[model samples]
Target: MQAVLRAACRAAADLLFPRNCVHCAGPVETGSYQYLCPACTRALQFCEPPACKTCGYPYFGSVIAPRECPHCAELEPVFDKGKTLFLAKGPGRSLLHALKYHQGFYILKDLTRMLKETPHFKEFLSGAILVPVPLHPTKLRERGFNQSEHLAHTLLQNSDARAVEPLLLRSEFTHSQTHLDRKDRLQNVKNAFALSATANLMNDTYYILVDDVFTTGSTLNACARTLRTAGVTHLRAVAIGHG
Candidate 1:
């Protein structure tokens, strides 16, 4: 009854003040996603198979032979594999920015919907334990939330993932990697993470690191190194977008 009431209330509220697209300042009238207009929804470039195993970037349909992904060519990943939802361009970029910067919590429903409907997405996440990339204490206090942690929870609810484990902690408040080169980004995060005291990982179980976006993968690699040092043998990673 409460859920029904909430839905009814939301419907009435939407009618009163229609939601605007995150990418464009247009009314979201008809689209599979609630936060994007139909054109923007159609503009999303989803990742498909024959993708880069390291960063989940598509191979542009080149099935001839697997080649190195330019995105993470220099990365030496501690995790066994990586998967992402879409290219972090166009509407996809705005979607993540909205969540990461604007406190767009309402956009989570779109993630759930995508996980349920996107081909092979749920399968990739269904059986693993998810670990969200951590934010430093200072950053956490400033941001009031960790977007990666929110992503982990949404994935847990949407897929058959075992559980969400905050098994890593950012011990150092590293400078933001937004404008840094790949080398600088790596150096900034090096030795910045530590294994959390609450972590009780098993050798045989699959573990997947979750984040909102995959840039040069420096940050994720840093987190994975910490987990690997703590004896996570079966590990992989997933993100909403590959930038």
Candidate 2:
């Protein structure tokens, strides 16, 4: 009875102030939480075809071959495989910025919706424990919350998958690698992570490390290296976007 009453109150409130779409800023007639108008959502370049099988990065034109991109082929990723919901263009970029910089927690629902409905990622979740890449303590303090953690939780909650936050730790705070080249980025984060001493990882367990974006992939590689060393046999990853 209380739950029904609360839902009724929320419905009435939504009727009073219909939520606007996040992408187009138009009135949502259905009083829903979707941030994009249907038309705008269609206009966005959803990562459909020509996507790399290993990382799910949408490739334009005819050039790349199977199982890899120029980026991933040159140097293999530490993680065994990866996939993404969107190709990190159009509304993808804007929504990610909102989630990271503007505290757009509401985007979690939309992001998770995309993840859950993607057929490529649906049954591929077996043996996968969702793990969010960790932010350094200082960065976490400044940001007030880890955006990657929010994304990971969304994946877990929507997919009914087990999520573990205790498997990785930032051993020491390192300088941000936003401006660094790939080599320097890798070096900057070297020795920056350690497997939690209390982590009870089974040798056969598979983990899917989550993050907001995949740039140089140096950070995820480091985390995957640590997990591999800790006896984890199968590792996969997914990011909100692939830069």
Candidate 3:
């Protein structure tokens, strides 16, 4: 009965609002939940094996054994491991821009669905709590929502993760890292995050940090350092893309 009621409500919503593709803003087919049209969906490139063991960045060459990428080797990441769903290019990049800057909440449903299908998403998040990389109050007000928090919540729908907890807070507002070099990017986020006063830290609990993209991984690393300082011993991260 509840299922039938939900179907009726969904049908009514389609009639009223009419769902549109989050990627291209085209009309979605009736009863279709794919937030992207078939063309855009096909354009999404899922990260496959032969990636860096530490950061999960896809490797271009053949692989006989798992290895850390040069970046991971040079400066170790604070998190135990990291995973991402897609390469940060083409449709994946456009989708992220739309969702982050254009109020594309509809993309969450399909994005989470894809994240759930990633190779190690389930295994990595199996016994963890979700901790979204936070935005400063100023940025939060401007954007109206934290994309990472939404991603964490959507992922929670299919995982055994305990809950989505915004335990971390941005202590300082920083410039955007979009065009910054690795050194500058790391410097930009330095001392930018801190554990919230209301947070309860469980030393034994695994916390999975969530984010929209991993570029130099500076932001995520900074967040991990703060968590570690606050006595969090086990950490992992998942992102929508590896830029």
Give the alpha carbon lDDT tens digit for every residue of 23-69 in model 1.
99799977798998999998999888879888899889548866888
Worst 10 residues of 2 by lDDT: 28-37
Please give the ranking of all candidate structures by lDDT, highest first, separated by commas: 1, 3, 2
Query: What tens digits encode model 2's per-residue C-alpha lDDT throughout 1-243?
Result: 999999999789879987677666787665323776666576555555567655667787786455457656644677888776675666677778889998999888777667656756655565478888888788889999989888887777767466656578888898878789888988888788898778888766678888888777788888888898888888887887777
Best by lDDT: 1
TM-score of 2: 0.84
| Every model's TM-score | 0.95, 0.84, 0.87
Instruction: Give lDDT per model, in order.
Output: 0.91, 0.76, 0.82
**Candidate 2 Cα misplacement greater than 4 A, ranges:** 1-12, 24-26, 30-33, 60-68
Candidate 1 pairs with clashing backbones? none
Instruction: Give the clashing pairs for model 3.
Output: none
* lDDT at residue 109 of model 2 (Cα atoms): 76
